[model samples]
Target: MDRIVVQAAAFDAGAEIASLREHDASVGAVAAFVGQVRDLNGAQGVDVLELEHYPGMTEASLAAIVADAHARWSLRGVTVIHRVGPLKPCDPIVLVAVASAHRGEAFQACEFVMDFLKTEAPFWKKETADGVSRWVEARERDDIAKQRWQGAGADEATQDKATHDKATHDKATEGTRARPRRA
Candidate 1:
């Protein structure tokens, strides 16, 4: 069973898990992830967030992601729920759950589904903070996370390692720089 829901109403993650467990007797493990709205985003104080998505397309995209996860793992069931519309801090945003006959498959499939959802899903988010509103930009880290599953070429991995090396070196030397001290 693959259950995908995109709505504005809040869903109970606990109930969703229980439902999946009851769906199959052969299920031995279930893994899940819940994303929630936060009060702060980096240096900004977020007042509220509005999520928008193309109705039919959004559901179809989610289904595709679930299908990919199923193909990669031996999952018995998958459940995904994503909320849209006005949401305040601490509100639930999304949920991804997977059930399998083994713990490893369930865990990997759950993570894979979320990684793809964050980068591939067609959901736009507008954040209002400090009398300002802006669309959230896609994070590079999310892209990198998704790339791990893409079988990225060794050249790309080498470049990523070099970038990480430079960042680490810079950080280690940052504190050694001379700076004006407060009187």
Candidate 2:
């Protein structure tokens, strides 16, 4: 079954979790997160939140995030659902769930999918408050959270190359200081 869903209709989180579990009995642990629309935005009271996304681009981005999680962890199943259109406070915004043989992989992969989705996915949010609407910006903390996965060694080959280049440069320039010389 496809693991990514982008829709305007609301989804039942409990049902979604059950579906993931039923699909794979070998999954011993399931970790999930459901994000909701908040009533408050900073100091202002939020009346509604409108979520918009680029259709194909959004789905592709989400699929890539899920694939990245699978590549980094031993995952049995993954579910990512993101809602679009107008939503009120307490309405579910997103869901990220992962199933694995152990709790650690499920927990980490669930978090990884969400962190990347928040920063990497092509979703735009607009908040309406006091008859005014404004687009929200990505949080710095979200970026920092996503960065933690970079050290997972997905780019170890690239890192190795950088290290090799530095070593080569150091060896080539060992004890060499450039100075003006007389012709």
Candidate 3:
């Protein structure tokens, strides 16, 4: 089973992992990653983080990423949850969990999902610190991480689709940045 969610609500990591393992008896190892809103980005103290995305497009992109993982590894189960809206420091941002018969596949799939999510997803983030807000730029490190997976698990066709999807998304959301709602 594969579950993908994009919401403004927070998620329970333990419950997600438990649910992933509960339905499958063959799952011998479960690997998970929880990303939280940090209090600081380098020296700047972060007060709030806001994430936004195109509703239908974001979910479709995530499904493609999960499907690619399934194509690459023998995963028993996978769950991905990414939160949006205004978030405070220390708030949970995303969760990626994978269940497999062995540890290696589970670990690799979990990492692959996260790496793809960071670079390929349509999410936009803005960080506010000292009452000033700035949209977070795409990180070179994340692009590098995503590049390493090329030609690893997915074949040329799958890779081409991923590239096409990313290009389409970038074109669609070219100049848009999520703005904070005034209170």
Which consecutive 10 residues in model 1 have the weakest lDDT in total?
Answer: 174-183
Task: Report every candidate's CA lDDT.
Answer: 0.82, 0.81, 0.84
lDDT of 3 by residue, 1-183 (tens): 889999999999999999999967988789999999988766565488999898999999999999989887778899999999999988999999999876656877899999999998999999899889999999899988887778545664575575456546645765432221111
Off by over 4 Å in 3: 41-46, 152-183
* Evaluation by lDDT, superior candidate among 2 and 3: 3
Residue 119 of model 3 has an lDDT of 90
Model 1 misplaced stretches (Cα beyond 4 Å) = 41-46, 152-183
Q: Encode model 2's per-residue lDDT on 42-87: one tens digit a residue.
A: 6566588999999999999999988878777777889999999999
Each model's total of backbone clashes? 0, 0, 0
Q: Model 2 off-target regions past 4 Å?
A: 41-46, 152-183
Clashing pairs in model 2, backbone N/Cα/C closer than 3 A? none
Measured by TM-score, how close is model 2 to the native structure? 0.79
Q: How would you encode candidate 1's per-residue C-alpha lDDT over 1-183 as one tens digit per residue? A: 889999999999999999998958889789999999988756566588999998998899999989888776678899999999999888999999998876656776798789989998899999899878889899999998888767557855774575456546645764322111111
Taking all chains together, the TM-score of candidate 3 against the true structure is: 0.80
The true-versus-predicted C-alpha distance at residue 100 of model 1, in Å, is 0.4
